[model samples]
Target: MYVVIFKAKVRQFDDQYSQTANRMRELALTEFGCLEFNAVTEGDLEIALSYWPSEEHIKAWKQHPEHLAAQQLGKQRWYESYSVEVVEIKRSYKSGSY
Candidate 1:
């Protein structure tokens, strides 16, 4: 499994940002090989984590038109700065009740 971690320092988040975020999450889960998607915001910081089956899917997601637009918007308005990391998951363990 591959994990993509995205961290951003938010400059602003308006209604459009919220709509775009929700759309992207939905598209990723439905159209791509996205296993899990998670996001959280606190103060000026926002963090998102997504699990993918391979790097190809990540590349495809990056070049998706809607996502590209969102990236540009982030640069122009929503985010002050952002960083993304792709890492290989060596192992994972979980035991809980949902």
Candidate 2:
């Protein structure tokens, strides 16, 4: 498994940003090979973590047209700054049954 960690400092957000983000999340799950996604916001900061099956899947997601547009919009309007990291997951564990 692989993980994509995205951290951003929000700038300004409007209704369009919410719609776009929801659409993108749906695409990540349905179109891309995203296993799981979680995002949280605190103050002006946001962090999103997504799990994927492979780097190829991650690449495909990154190159998606709508996603590309969102990236541009994020930089241009929604986010002040952001950083993304792709890391291989050597192992993961759960304490007990969900």
Candidate 3:
């Protein structure tokens, strides 16, 4: 398994950002084989994490046309700065009462 962690310092977030985020989430889960996706924002900071089965899938998702456009928009208008890290998950565990 792999996890992609994205962190950003937001410059602005308008209705377009919200709508595009919702659409991208749907596209990622339904079309990009994203196993899990999570995002949070506080003040100017935003973080998003997504899990994937393989690096190929991650690369594919990164190159997706819609995602590419979003990236450009982030650079141009929405994000002041951002970083992405892709890590291999060697082990994972969860324990709780369902």
Rate residue 94 of model 2 by lDDT.
86
Q: lDDT per residue, candidate 2, 23-84, as tens digits?
A: 99999999998999899999999999999999999999999999999999999999999999
What tens digits encode model 1's per-residue C-alpha lDDT throughout 5-43? Answer: 999999999999999999999999999989999999999
Q: Rate the local accuracy (lDDT) of all candidates.
A: 0.96, 0.96, 0.95
User: lDDT tens digits, residues 1-98, model 3?
Assistant: 99999999999999999998998889889999999999999999999999999999999999999999998998999999999999999999889963
Where does candidate 2 stray beyond 4 Å? none
What's the true lDDT of residue 20 in model 3?
Answer: 89
TM-score of 1: 0.97
List the lowest-lDDT window of 10 residues for candidate 2: 89-98
Q: What is the C-alpha RMSD of each candidate to the true structure, in Å?
A: 0.8, 0.8, 1.1
Per model, state how many residue pairs clash: 0, 0, 0
Checking candidate 3 for backbone clashes, the offending pairs are none
